[model samples]
Target: MVLDLITIGWRYTMDFRRPTTTAPAQTPEEAYRQLRSLADESALRNLGALYSMAVDDHDIDTVVAMFAEDGSFTRAGHTVQGHTALRDFYIGMMDRYVTTLHIPNSHVITVDDDTATGILTGQAELSLNGTLMMAAYRYDDRYARQDGRWVFAARTLKFMYVVPIEQMPTSFGDSKRIRWPETPYAEADLPEALPTWDSYKC
Candidate 1:
């Protein structure tokens, strides 16, 4: 049945082979290398979840430690580099919220030697200045192995929408979906704004 499926152009989606172009490892050394690669990929993907937990917990130290010493983070046009800058950035940002719960939904990672890149999507429920708000967002990440552990080399954050939870129903249909309290309404940075999204239109 499996061979018949393959003959009909149905590739095995459950294959655990890495670098898909290559065949399965035959020698023990080659097997070890493949295992190491998978381990690195797992660690890199976990970085996103670890970051979300640290941020929601207001743990600046753990958050900054996830990045390389000279790593950087970019969000909403502002970029902060190095551990000191990253530490300060999170400190100020977390202070604006009374509490937050970040849910990391999905992550896709590509590994090349000791470096990697990933895209992560998630949502968050926030208590900002006592007002309940929700956000849908994505992170574009770059990672490097340093001292035998994966760390973020750089990360860029983009928001699909951020609105008061009560406004969720109407927010997506509105042009300006970023509805932060006391701030002017602003456009979301996803879907319609993505190049592929525009190309797919009729």
Candidate 2:
């Protein structure tokens, strides 16, 4: 009897330390707002997936259509704004690759009414001048609702590594991991470049 009482007392202490509270029921307006937010987030995620599919298929028109009229895309310090510039940029990029496959992963998005932002990490396999290259990359994106649809407002691409598939074994050890054909070796732009990574080192 004494042991049972001790066990019960310990259980009560734990329950008091970690009290549980029931959440208030949502009103109809609150529920509707939540559903809308979920739909927007789903659309925003589809934007990234569709982009990868279009790029791999060389469907430049479809890729460009995913962006807002005034949207901008930036890569390697170059920024192209508006649909015309965006189209030209994508065309030029696609022309360099014989074929490509992009796999997008780990997309995190935040919705704030009609506007949102996201970060996407992905990898790609490209046939550049007959040399197969593997690349790990990330995209920082801003999105807006245009004509009741979510479209990219701006996107910036950054690379963690882009090396010839054959050189993958040794490339990670090299300080300069970006080994695009015909271009000078360049440093990777990722984990090490992240501010949080640096903060932890200190």
Candidate 3:
């Protein structure tokens, strides 16, 4: 009889606790906004994927067209601006590599009105002068909605590390400093500083 009374008392205490309140229903405008945001994110991701493929295929024209007319690509502290300059840069870069493949590790995009920003991290394999070279890179990209399409307004490349396949050590120790390559252009054309340390280094 005592045990039964204790069980009943516990049940009565729980009954007085309030149930969780559900979130309010989203309004029509809120629903539409969320849908639009999703679409924009999808388009931005597609843009990055296309870029990787185009570069690996040595399709310079297609790659250049993916950017805005006034778009710019900055790499290794040097900035290439305008369609003409970007085309030349890609052509020269492709010439240096007989074959290449870029494997995207991850990408994330944040949308703001007609503009968006994204970061892409990837590993690249290149055959240069009969030697295989591997590189890890990150691109900080800015996108603008032009003519209802997402196009790159600016893309900045940060090379985490690049080493000949045979030269890569089994482990990256400390990784507090990085060995940055010299720019292909004159010193005047490069940025003041370049980031070398890994962003997610433990």
Candidate 4:
């Protein structure tokens, strides 16, 4: 259900500024520190891609794999957790659509050693039996390093808008990689984390 509320959106003034993080070492000492930072950045970006690959492959298993064992996905007023909800949600969606495109852009990735956080802004368009619908929102994610791997621990999202098929609006694209846009942006692309995004295996 896409909202009819449309006004060129602006940055939300949140009482909370940035996520709290650990202090980086003052040591300009080793190349390893910089490498670790880069690696962490890479992992954060992968968080976004994992979501894309999960939906694109129609593999809820891959989707759930992106999360920690007790991790949860929250959107709108619904929350899905563990693995069962993960499976059920996607399986249920299959009844209505054959394919979906998850266009993620404006990603904000924050990293520190064994933990990182991300805010992913993007739109998703679903083509159900040839009918098209679009949705726009932000995914505020909390990730942790578990057993030497990065996984989503919590995901909070807020919908900015949606354009349903009933409205005859069609700007959604097909199944492919989504590129980030560059204007009138309510969202911002802070940094990219390729490691987190690349966790999903096709």
Against the true structure, what is every candidate's RMSD?
8.2, 13.0, 16.3, 12.3
- Judged by whole-model lDDT over C-alpha atoms, candidate 2 comes out at 0.81
Candidate 1 regions with alpha-carbon error over 4 angstroms: 1-23, 26-30
lDDT by residue (tens digit), candidate 4, 15-70: 23343344566677656776776787787787678778777778777877888888
Candidate 2 lDDT over residue span 74-179, tens digit each: 7877789999999998999899899999999887777788898777889999999989999999887889998899999988888899999999988887768888
Backbone clash total, candidate 1: 0
Q: What is the C-alpha lDDT of each candidate?
A: 0.81, 0.81, 0.70, 0.63
Clash number for each model: 0, 0, 0, 15
lDDT: which is higher, 2 or 4? 2
**Model 1 per-residue lDDT tens digits across residues 1-202:** 1112224222111222433455689999999878887798788768888889999989889999999999999888778999999988899889888899999987767688888777788999999887999999888777898988899998888889999999998888886988999999998877666544655465
Worst 10 residues of 4 by lDDT: 1-10
Residue 196 lDDT, candidate 3, scale 0-100: 16
TM-score of each: 0.85, 0.85, 0.74, 0.65
Question: What does candidate 3's lDDT look like per residue over 90-131, in tens digits?
Answer: 999999889999988777777788997776788888887777
Model 4 alpha-carbon drift over 4 Å, by segment = 1-31, 165-202
Worst 10 residues of 2 by lDDT: 9-18
